[model samples]
Target chain A: MTETILKVDNVSKAFGALRACDRVSLDLRLGEIHALIGPNGAGKSTLIKQIAGNLRPDSGRIEFLGRDVAALDTVERARMGLGRSFQISAVIAEFTVLQNVVLAVQGARGTSFHFLRGALSDRAVTEAARLQIERAHLGGREAVRASDLAHGERRRLELAMALALRPKAFLLDEPMAGMGADGVAEMTGLLDGLRHEAPILLVEHDMDAVFALADRISVLDYGQIIASGTVDEIRAHPEVRRAYLGEEDAA
Target chain B: MGRETLLNAAIALGLVAVPVWAHLAGEPFIITLTTKAVILALAGVGLNIALGHGGLISFGHAAYFGLGGYAAGILAHHAQTFTPLMSAPFIIEGTKFMPVIWLVAVIVAGLAALVIGALSLRTSGVYFIMITLAFGQMLFFFAISWPAYGGEDGLVIYVRNEFPGLNTLDPIQFFALCYVILGLALWFSHRFGRSPFGLALNAARQNAERVQTVGIRPFRLRLTAFVISGMITGLAGALFADLNRFVSPSMLSWQTSGEIMIFIILGGVGRLYGPVAGAALFIALEHFLGGVSDYWLVFVGALLLLVVLFARGGIIGTLAGREVAHD
Candidate 1:
């Protein structure tokens, strides 16, 4: 594996009596798609939230770029090249798609504090934003209000924004949750191309997309990893079958 | 031309034209009435920055307003009596200069906003509103207890403060001073709304989580807007105290805070001239309706109810038509 870009060491989180993430450890290598699959309430979300710096883990540490990031908040982590896509598709609905992406571009460049010069007149920010939007196949929809876009288009817009940061690593939480069949296929193709750009930590439910795009798969059940290996290895793992894919699939 | 542009021009022209016509006809009282509208509109513009653009509903802005009024009253008091305000270090003598008073007013208000915003912005929704209102009331009660400047009875200025190259006591000249200030404020608000900082603040208001994901701190953006908003309102408060030649606790009341909010809500929230339009309508109703009956506010209340129910975008948005979607 290439140099590990993100390392989660024995991370754990609990809410009251229920243990959400129990000593979870995972590492994402450069230019690799690491898929995390689990049943509902498998503590997958808890782990992702901790890594994204949104929730504080009770134990262990999260290290990004070989430095401990346990003290950082979400915005600090984001500024340090940790790009993320929200599961519910968070976006400023009042802003135009171009403005939304431009806001991200400005953030990445650390020039969003400019007050006097009109942002609409800035060619550099506008061009960079346009390029990201175009890459997401949203070329003509730049001026469209974000809320007016279709559900799948909003997902694409979110991806475009996430990519605008030129992030070293991506943490996408169910990016395909609300997409239709064609949109899913299109997104899978898009993500398949994006692996060379950066490593992606994908937490998804679509097995076909996971099997097709993931370089390696890790099965999570009840806040613990049952199995972790290459796609075919995970496909043939007997314990994973009984725990996740079901015994009938193994037969 | 687009409807918004045409209506904007008309509003600007109407505000100026009526005052000019009344001035030439030798009816100076009409000019005083229009000047009242202009000054209140200036206060509304200040509130718009926090409420409309920054999406901070500060129910305690009257604190700055009252403070600004007191700053003017206190300074003029010392200047008129030929007494130095302080002697411990160097003597701090008060001045009758309007510019100096305005500077002090803006700084005092800006500082107050910084403190209140720092605390109140930590909460949101109804909590934010209540915290701000509580702060205003705290100051209000303090002003009532402090009898040095007349306390609840209020302080009065015998002569209006001086402005360079003008007789400020003259109604027309005073109106001109206010008119020029309002125009500059309007222009500033216009340029500010489209700048990067303003856009980021707007995004923060709409979805703070999204802003954080993009690596921007919503709190910083909000605090900056709040300070600027307070300074503007404070300037208006100084002028307002000058307008009545009096500084009173009524200026700091929660009812005054509600009135400022009414100006914004009755105008377009995000529109540049919303406060101007709202202020004009309010002044007109107060003057005309109050002249006609003892209970004119009932009619005004009914009118406000109608606007809130049906015209959600306020007078500016209603007249401008739906925003034309660009290709």
Candidate 2:
């Protein structure tokens, strides 16, 4: 077994009467894409928020590199290499693509205290930003303001920012969301290659992409994991069919 | 140079030229009016760092301004009276030196901002604005009730503070000193908006959650900007008190905070020289319109409404075009 880079052990979250996540236990090992799939209200967002440090679990421990990170905030988690991409693209609308990527690079390298020098002028940050921009296929549009970018391009920009973190693991929420067929295909290839750099905890709606990329699949239903297994095992799982995946996939 | 840069240069030249031309025409009062504009512009510039770049609408900035004025006034008062600032412990003495007064004002204001920002930054938007206003009002009433500083009657300085070789008593000399300080402030503001810290702060303003996900805490960034902003405004307050030869509770009033915010809105919220343009226009309107009618501020109010309704970017944004990415 490869080393477990991220461990989510018995995490539970409740909002009033509704439990968002209930005793969720999952882990991402090095160099694997572990896909979390569910219906609209399957508590995927809540789980991702808990993992990303945006929401707190009522009980359970989240360990990154064998150390518990339940006390950390979102900023602290990001600093500790827990890269996250939002479902709705969250790039700085006013900043150019390069600027957005440079922010992530600056954050990762701990250069935010630099008051005198321009972030762009810093060769180290800019170079890293450029590399990530290229990796995310945003090479020619470096100077484009994030707001002006096409929907697919904005998603790519998020990926670029996430990559710039040099993260130990990625908690990507719907990276293929709002993309056309071509965009989905391109992102699928990108996520396919991304597993080598860092393990990915992908929360995606696209079944095609998830099935193609995920070494292991976790099917979430009403804040509980109905099934957790390899792609073939999850496909064949009877409980997963009734709760999620639907009768269509099973047939 | 860019269009805004050219416009800024023109405004700079116009500010200097008007005072000089007024001095040549023997219109000392006009020069004084221009000096007031410069000092107010400096205050606006200070607020812009927090309000504009950091998206922190600090409605209580007048607290720093008033504290700065009181620092200069109290120091000069004690200096002339030959009394130590404190009788016990360290036995610190007061001096009527401009640099020392300015230093003290900046430090005091910065410290105040640190405390205020620590509490206030926890809430955002309207809550943030109200809390800041509350803090400013608290200071205002404190100053009004404090008998040692003459309460609401205010403190008067017999002479302006000294600044090395130049005679600060001369209008032009004093104007020159203010102009130099304003220039330094504008240069700093320009550079600050492009720096790494500025980038992070700006990002935090636009999308704080995005900023956090990028591993930067918006609270620390905003607090730092607030302190720096307060320090700058405080410096302006000292200059303003020196200019008037009086320090009063009115300097700490909510109306003063509104006026500083007006300077930013009138010029351009985040524009480098937005406050400069806004301050100059505001003073000009007050001077020219006050002579015409007692309700001169009505016209200013109307203009502010028009700016808000039509030109959302304010004066510089309307004139120079929409905000462009500096990078």
Candidate 3:
């Protein structure tokens, strides 16, 4: 078995009287793609937020690479090689594609205070950003403003930015949420290629994409995990069949 | 390398030539007016860091400006009596050199910014504006009631403070000093706008969530920019004190804060030369309109409202037809 890179031990979160995440626990290992799937308001986003250090869990422990990361802030977690992509595309609109990616590289390189020299003109920085852009299939769109990119292209740019950090683990929230057929395919292919590079915690609703890309699927209902298994095991589970898959087949 | 650079250089050269002509034509008042314009523009450039690029509307910048002026005023006052600042274990006496005054102004204002930013950044949107305004008022009241250095009436230097190898009393020479400092501050603002930190600051303004997800803390970035902004404005305040040979609590007033913001908006927000253009236009309008009538501020207010409603992008922004390309 691959070594576990992330461990979430019985984490729970609540909003006033409403339980957003209830006793959720999951482990992610190297070289495996873990998918967390649920209906709307299933507390998937809340759970992911806890892991990304944007929200603190009400009760539970989160350990990353054997360190207790429950108290670290978002930027601190990111600096420790935990990369996240938002559910909504969050690219800087006014900045050019190259500048956006270069910022990501700058974050990783620890040279944000270099004021005298132009950031774009730095050979090493540009080379690194160029490689990441090419990896995300944004090689031809380097000079284009992020605002000018198509919807699908913006999604890809988000992925490109996350990858630029060279993270040890990736927490991707709905990488294909608003994407069309072609966009989904491109994203799936990108995810397929990324499985060998780092562990991925994917929270998505597209059953077909999840089953195709996820090595292990976890079904979340009402903020609690109803079942967790391989794709065949999840497909055979009676509760999952009645609650989630049945609605999909009916549609 | 770009048309923007050429235009900037031309404008700078034109400004430098103005005082030279004034010197030759024996118009000392013109030199004084130009000096005032340059000093105000320099201060505007400082505010532009937070206002234009960082998207932080700081209404308390006048506090730093006043602090700088007070630094100059207090130093010159003490220097005349040869009094020690502490008179204890460490004897720190005052000096009248521009460099010493500028250094003190920058340091004090930068520290003030750190405190103000740490507190003001806790709120966003309209709340941020109000908090900054409240801080500015606090400083203004302190200066007015303190009883030190002439209090509400203001402190005046008997002579313009001297600089090494320069006649500080000459109108044209003093104007040249103000012009050169303004030029340096403008260059600094331009360079800061293109740096990595500046890019991140702009990113934070555009999409703060995105900037955070990429591992940059928005609050820290904004605070840093705010401090730098205060330091630059504080330097300008020192220059202004020298220009008028006085320091007053009026430098800390909310009206001064509003005027600084107006300069940026009237020229074009976020443009490198916007503050310069805005300052020049504002001073020119004040001069011409004040000469024509005593109630010139009413016209100025009307014009500002019109610009805000119809122009949207200020004078240079209207002419340029595009946003300044940052990062």
Candidate 4:
């Protein structure tokens, strides 16, 4: 088996009386898209938040790149190469597409303390940002303000920033949340190619995209992983059918 | 070149030319008035770094400004009296040299800013504003109770502090000195706003959480901007004291902080030359309206209301269009 790049060991969290995540254990290896799918309240977002260091689990451990990261903050975790995208697109609204990506490049490469030189004129950072922007298929809209971009383009811009992190693992939270059918198809193709760059832990609601793109699917229901397996096995799991996918959808 | 750049050049030239014309026409008071505007504009520039770019609204900047003025006042007072500033820890004598006073003022103000920013940056929005205002008030009262420096009566320099190779006592010369310093400050603010750090600071302002997700801490950026802002305002405060040959607790008051904020708002909050325009308009309003009525500030308040409601981006923003101000 490929060496595990990210490991979540029995992580559980609760909000007052509600258990958002209950002893959830999962792993992402060297090169694979691990999709975490569930109904709206099944605690997928809560799990993603814990792994991204935005929330602390009530009980359990998260290990990234064979190192314990229990005490690190969101910024530190991102620096350590765990890139993430928000469920709702969260690009800097006033910044141009190029500027937003340039900031991400600057963040990942280390210190942003260079105070005299113009950020856009820095050839190295700007070039890297351009590459990512092109890869995300937002080539011609470099100077367009993020607020002015179309809904799908903003999602692409978010992905561009995540790619600029040059991360070891990606913790993507619903990459296709508000995208249209065409946008989904294009994103699915884009994500299909992204697995070669880094292992992705995708939390998505689009079942067709999930089924098509997931190398391994984990069925989450009521804050617990009901089943985990390859697409065929997950499709065959009886309990997963009852708890998450109905009989018609599972078939 | 951009229209804003042209406008900035015209404003700069006009500032220098008016003072020169007044000197030739024997109106020394005009030069003094222009000097005051320039110094106040420099303070506004400092606050802009925090409020405009970093999205930090610091309501206590007068603390640094007053501290800077006191640094100059206290130093000049001791120097004129031929007394040692301290004797126990180390023998430190005061100096009247402009460069030395400026250095002390910058360092003192920068240090205070560091402390205030470190604490105040912990909260944001109204709480941030309130915390900063509280700190400023603390300094104001501290200055009032410190009788060694004349307490509420304030301290006065017997002579204007000396600058190298120039008679600073001359109104035109002093105005020129202030103009040059203001020019340097505007240049620095311009460069600082476009730098890589500035980009991150701007991004942090727009969305701090997004900045964090990209592995950048917004607090550090904001605190740095605040300290730098405080340092510049402190420098301006020192110069302001030198201009009047006096330093008072009123320099540390909440009213001073509000005036500084008004300067930024009047010009265009984030625009590079916003402070310069704001200060010019303010001084002009005060000079013209004060003659008409004792309640001149009410008119200024009305103008501010109009700008906030209709102008959105302030004077420059209204003239140059909104697409390209800070950038």
Candidate 5:
């Protein structure tokens, strides 16, 4: 098997009496699109949050590139080439789309504090930002304010921002949550292309997009993985059908 | 090419021309008033870094402003007495100039910012505001209680400090000095807003979690902005001491902090020239209203409430409208 880029070992999280995440274990491999699917409140976001270093799990270990990263902060993990796109659109509303992407490029370049020269005037930073924007199909939208962009374009901008980091792996949460048919197709095509570059762990509810794009599918129920297998195996599994897909597939 | 640059240059030119007109028209008081406006505006610009761009409501900026004023005052007092600042450790005397006083002010304020920011950054929202206010009150009391160079009474300068080859005693010339520094501070604030570090600071304000996920520490970025903001305000304080030839505990009061915040809000929060516009309006209001009635502050307070309620953006913001870029 290809080397595992990420390993979550028996991670559990609790808040008061609720076990938000319970002993969830998973492995993500190199250059593969792995999908984590579940009903609402099934703890998929919580798991993603833990993996992205936003929240610490009560009991678990996360290993990335052979080192345990449970103690690392979010930014430190990002600097180590871990990129995450938020479930909510979190672009700087006042900044131009190009400026937002440039910030990410600057972060990856490790020169966020260079004060004498204007960041806009820096040729290398702008060029890299432009390249990432183009790669994410946001070529013409560069001059628009992030707030002015359409919801789908904003989602694309978030992806462009993540790509700007030149990340080793991507943790994407609902890239297609609010997209229409055209938006979904465009984003699916983009993700399909990115699968050749870095490992991607996507948390999505769009089963059609998930099955079409994911190399491996994991069904999460009540903060626990009920089933994990290839598309065919997940489609054939009775437990997954009883818990999630039975009603939907019947319709 | 950007609208921000055009507006900043326009304000700078207006300020530079004011003293020239004062010099020609034989109105020396105009020059003094202009200098006062410029100095206070520069202080506002400093506060704008934390409040506008960084989204840090530092209600205690008067601490740095007062510290700067005291540095100039204490140094000038010791220089006149022909007393070394320290004899047992080493011999250190005081010199009066725009540069030396500014340096001392910047260093002192920067150090204080480091300590205050470390503590204040621990909390956010209302807690942050209260913590900063608490720190400002602490310094205000300390300045009032210390019986060194005037205490509650105030310190008076026999002569204005000198700048190299500039005569320094002429009111118009002094106005020109303050105008140039204000212009520089405005430019610095504008440039800082567009820098990479500035982008992160703005990002942190918008979304702290997003910034962290991108691999940037929010606290460190904010702390850096806070220190730079304090240093800039401190420089303005040094000039302010020379403006009135006086330094008092009132300079460090919470009222002073509120006034600085008012300058940013009244002009247009986060706008490049917001502080300048706000400073000009505030001084003009003070001059005009104070001449008309002693109850002018009541009107000022009413106007501030109006701005906070109806006009979310200050005067420049209302004039410029919401489409103006502010980060």
Candidate 6:
């Protein structure tokens, strides 16, 4: 049997009175989009945070490529091939798009302790970053500041940065949240091709995209995964239909 | 030439010209005054690394400055008396060599920054500012209470430390020594500002979480910046002590920190030559205004208020007209 690329084991996180994630278990296989969809306050963001190392789970283990990552911080986890995109658009707003992606490229390598040489002059890293930027369809906007970018463009820039990391697994939180109709279609096509490079654990509210891209759909509700199966199987699942979809068909 | 480069060249020339012109005109007082300004300018350069580039508003930099002064004063004092610094298994005698004094001052201050930065970097905003200030106050009060050196009175070196072939007693020669160091530091700062590490640091200042996701630890970058800041400021402190032949606890005071901050704010926060212009302007204001009335601070306050309200980037920014892409 082929080992899963990412494994999240019985992760549980509780706020004083509210349980954010309760014994949630999932696995991501290579070249597959495992879409996790839930209503508001279903703990999607909290679960993503745990995997990204932004928050510590009360009792659970996250393994990337078969290595336990409980001790690693977000940076260390990222260095170990766990790429993440924030729910909110997060980019170095003061930096140009090229500069922002170049920083990600520089970090993709080992420690960036080189103090004497200029970063812009490092052609290899800058060239690689340029490729990712182009891949994200941001070719002509290289010199534009991140702050000045449109909402959809910032999302693309975030993808450019995450893709630059060359991660084995992607934990993207609400990647399609703020996108407009055209932006959504464009990003949907991008994420479709992206899964061929590495497995993705997508947490999005876009059901159309979920139906289009997901190899498997997991319905989350009130800190628990109510159901998990292929899109066809999940649509027919009574608990998922009753608890989450109501009458809006997933098909 | 670019605006920044032209401004930098002008600053370097102007700082050097003031003392040389003053010496030839037989107004020796101006040379001494300029020397003070240059040394303080170097200290401001040091702070700019952490404050401007790193964006760590370290309000307690005077701790490193005063520590550097004490390093020189303590070593020179021991050397003059021909006493060993310690007498356990080995006898370590102090030397009146300027280079040795500088090395000691830089190391001592760097270590102090490491300790303080390690603890203070964990807290940010007003908490970080206060922590650094508290550390500075601790050192200031400690220096005042320690009677072995001179306590409140401060320690004095009878003669300035030797600088190999140069005449240390001659004001112009000493100024020349300090001027060369300032030049080297400015070059280093320019190189460092362009480095990849510097970029990551600037990024960290803007967003630490994003920096972390990029696989760079913002804490380490900030800590290194703080240490480098301390080392450079410490060297300036040693030079300043040599100029006055005095090492006082006042060097570590928060007032000294405020004055250092004023230099950066008045010049341009992140601009490399910002501190130099600021220090020169501050010294000029002091020398010219001190003769009029002792209430020079009130006017200084007014000018500072004007700069803060009208000029966001300081003198260099005003002269240069625009900001560079990366800075």
Lowest lDDT sum, 10 consecutive residues, model 4 chain B, at: B318-327
Q: Candidate 2, B117: how far from true, in Å?
A: 1.2
Q: Which parts of model 1 have CA positions greater than 4 angstroms off?
A: A247-251, B322-327
Error of 2 at A232 (Å): 1.5
Q: Count steric clashes of candidate 5.
A: 1
Docking class of 3: medium
Q: What TM-score would every model get versus the actual structure?
A: 0.97, 0.98, 0.97, 0.98, 0.97, 0.96
Pick by TM-score: 4 or 5, better one: 4
How well is each residue in B1-327 modelled by candidate 6, as lDDT tens digits?
Answer: 689889889989988898999889987788889999999999999999999899999999999999999999999999999888887899988879999999999999999999999999999999999999999999999999999899999999999999999998888899999999998898888888878888899899899999999899999999999999999999999999999999999999999999999999999998999999999999999999988999998888999998899997899988997656653
Report the lDDT tens digits of candidate 3 across residue range B1-327.
Answer: 455565567667877787789899998888888888899999999999999999999888899999999999888878876787677888888778888999999999999999999999989999999999999999999999999678899988767788888998999888888888898888788778888888889899998877777778889889999999999899989989999999999999999999999999988788888888888888989989999999988888988898899987677667666654543
* All DockQ scores: 0.65, 0.78, 0.61, 0.66, 0.59, 0.60
Give candidate 5 misplaced runs (Cα > 4 Å).
B1-10, B322-327
* Stretches > 4 Å off in candidate 2: none
Q: What is the RMSD of candidate 4?
A: 1.4
**Worst lDDT 10-window in candidate 1 chain B:** B318-327
lDDT of 2 by residue, A121-184 (tens): 9888899999999999999999899999999999999999999999999999999998999999
lDDT of 2 by residue, B1-327 (tens): 678778888999999999999999999999999999999999999999999999999999999999999999999989988889998878988899999999999999999999999999999989999999999999999999999979999999899999999899899999999999999999998888888899999999999999898899889999999999999999999999999999999999999999999999999999999999999999999999999999999999999999999997888999899666754
Residue B178 in candidate 3, Cα distance off native in Å: 1.5
Model 4 / residue A140 / CA error / Å: 1.7
Candidate 6 DockQ, CA atoms: 0.60
Model 1 Cα lDDT, one tens digit per residue, B180-285: 9999998888778877787888899898988888888999999999999999999999999999999999999999898888888888887788999999998898
The top-ranked prediction according to lDDT is 2
DockQ of 3: 0.61
**Model 6 whole-model lDDT (C-alpha atoms):** 0.92
Evaluation by DockQ, superior candidate among 4 and 5: 4
